[model samples]
Target: MGNGISNVKPSTERSEGGEHSNSSHPHKLDQFRYKVLKAATGKFCSKNLAGQGGCSDVYKGWLGYRTATPGCGLPVAVKRIKKQGYQGLDEWNNELRILSSFHHPNVVKLLGYCAEGVHRMLVFEFMCNGSLEENLSRECCREVEWSKRMEIAKGLARGLEYLHNMDPPVIHRDIKSANILLDHDFTPKIADFGLSRFGPQGDKTHLSTRVLGTEGYFAPEYIGTGHLTLKTDVYSLGVVLLEILSGLKAVKRYPNGRRIELSQWATPYLNDKNQLHRVIDKRIIKNVDMEEAYDFATIISQCLTQDPRRRPTITQVLHSLQHIESKHQHFA
Candidate 1:
């Protein structure tokens, strides 16, 4: 996060755009000084633990005070990768490579990293508000206004648009609520690039890879045929959109005792005039416009389209949400 690495030894020469000219990018990224990280994170103490996933443990830390370049210190999230086989190694390296190259306001900032021997860690700006999932929990109320929700949706759509508009178009294979972190102002930042992949180029339409994502959020086609594309991410975002609207899990229990997926259960009533409210959470519906709800639901339905090609692009989604936001602001 400070001046370009001087204390930490370089693993290899960096390319013009931060990307390695070759495929081997694991060791080519900026490595942080181990001692600095230890001091910042209190040596990975449990009290500083922010969260843990299957691949890594995230610890909250501070930096810059001792470096003599800033006031007080800046908070950072240090993700320590858990030991695993070859596949885990690849995911770790992929996250390092993808996040290092990305620079979007809605994308988590990767300040630096530590890739010494068996140790693999990534340093990112700490999000004070935690994740979207925590903010949308059952305890939440008017704090998450309808306008704020729309802003979050727009931010997420913009993040996806950035990924999809890249040279080869990167696909964030996993776009669940938990991966969307929030800043102090509640602005959403898309995190977790370990499952990200570049979409096929030229005449190729899709890449056939092992389907990997949270259950109930996977696009039907991707789950059925393992065919992945930008639309695959669109479908997952649709499920998240549904969660934002309904305040329900991607898959939840209904009174009928069947576990109804947000997509499966909400899709049928999204356009039904008499049943639209059945799927929306009651918390913010009173404050939201019905016309806007229907429009938003329509977008969600289009994103969850069974046919990937039939789904709207991330750009389209962002435009639609922004238009809605504009109307709401003018009328407010």
Candidate 2:
């Protein structure tokens, strides 16, 4: 991780050889990206397209020519950037730089980029299982079991650990269920690094000019001061953990004129055994190990602490999850 000063300001000059530097020169890879986009989407075939996000559309594609090994052809997902202003270019570059360099089993892999003309595109490993948000909120899907949820939590933590422990540490400004993708076997992978930033070497805090992220997941400090850090991701992860356990959205308004955040609503249940039953998802309640559930809840509480300094590191979080899983096995 790049540790400079606690409150060092970000440089106006973008880093060279990375996505940030390429933002100003769209001509460099515009044609290539366009070709890939066209090929991936079959001349922009709407049928093959998966979904559209705020700034880009994702399409399912197969790259028969590029094989990691013999007969191991590449099945990829292409993200085609929509035309916007200079701000859009920055997002493209950020995704490219961050995803290109980020190599982790739990992180979505960036195959390559198509940077042709005014169009920009990114190719990633296709996630067969789709986003975590879809599995949680969408109907007709099988409920995720406790063991599967634990696996997802561990995978996410491992991915975050990589970012937090980088030489110049990376901060995933956006960490939410919607940004987490799963593979064929339901393995979790962190996707979408457009809002990410590289923290200064040794710096505890980094200043952010713009406050951008999904509502209810932002860290208290980041929301109040516009400062970003590794802990910010931890806070979001905590919210995700609660959602996974309780089958609740991070921000939900109850019927009794009360709007409660997932973290807040679940906190009271973490410590009290009587309240624990109330916080768990109804689908898994009967089958879940009570001790395992309590342990997992405690870990989530630590991650969601209001004080950034108190939030457990991703490494610590992973260890806790692993311990809980082992404990569950022992009792089983």
Candidate 3:
């Protein structure tokens, strides 16, 4: 698609290598992102954009100035980082590197990137249906039918499986509902790799690093020890699965002073069929099958296992979801 950039000005000067010169200061790096945003939003107006993220605004654009096939235009999404935030050129570079390495149907495809002067931006295929967060959080939107939800979960698991089983293994340091986008058909595609990292090989149990993830989604072990592993991503995926099932925010601090994290709140109902009904989103209650609901709850339990080792591999998660989907084919 055609490239776009925002109007934000670079907060600081850029280095010869295209990265910000000030390595210690994060604010200065915001300049590069600002420039990139400006470039991405330059051609496409805000009206053409569909969404915005913590550090970027997403715009829908075209693949070429002129399409070879009429009405078959290639659609794309442009992500321009916010120049006023802590995100820097390094984060942009990391995303570019990781997305460039893999190509999977379940993973969002990185079309291209621009890292010139004080500008940094990433381009990807635009997901027409938007994020899972938008769909689940809305009260009047079309219900995420149980069969579709399972299909979405299976697609996400396959994407994560690719990341986890990669040579050296890529850990998606940030995995949440907002990062899981949906296609026109409502299939899930994993997005956002700015906080991701590649793990060590050859018997290394984990990669030690500073914890970086949404508050409630960080793995318990990673929070305690700062040890990054494939399991850490698995834990985050569990939180996402919980969100998909219960239609609750991962880190919702209720007014009752009871701070209910997804993992903590879902644990009690994980295996109890009677209690499982309480955790499901009320919107789809009448449409959901009881047996499939219990199976879905069990899958969430496996993913949210306290012991990282006990968590099912993404491959296993995919298989389980596929089984559930197969059982409910007629319902769709």
Best-performing candidate as measured by lDDT: 1
TM-scores, all models, native as reference: 0.87, 0.84, 0.81
Q: Write the per-residue lDDT of candidate 2 for residues 1-332, one digit (tens) a residue.
A: 12211121222343334332212211211124465557655676787788798888888776656432222356778888777655556777787765655556788877677765456777888998888888777373778888898889898988888777765778888999989999999989999898888875553456565789998798898889888878888999999998888877888887897776777778877877778889898888998988788888899889889999999888899889888878777877
- Model 1 gets an lDDT of 0.81
Query: How does model 2 fare in lDDT?
Result: 0.77
Task: Give each model's clash number.
Answer: 0, 21, 17
Local distance difference test, candidate 3: 0.75
Provide C-alpha RMSD values for all models, in order: 5.9, 7.7, 9.2
For model 2 the TM-score comes to: 0.84
**Best by TM-score, which number?**
1
| Candidate 2 off by > 4 Å | 1-33, 65-73, 138-140, 253-259
Of candidates 2 and 1, the better by TM-score: 1
For residues 1-332, write the lDDT of model 3, one tens digit per residue: 12343333322332232121212111222222333334344454766667766777777755543522222456767776666645655566677766766567778877666666545677788888889988888553677877688778888998888777766678899989989999999889999888999877898899999888888998899999999888888888988888888888898786888786878877898799888888898888888888888988898888888889998887788888888877777666
Positional deviation of residue 120's Cα in model 3 after best superposition, in angstroms = 0.9
Instruction: Candidate 1: list runs displaced more than 4 Å.
Output: 1-30, 66-72, 140-142, 253-258, 328-332
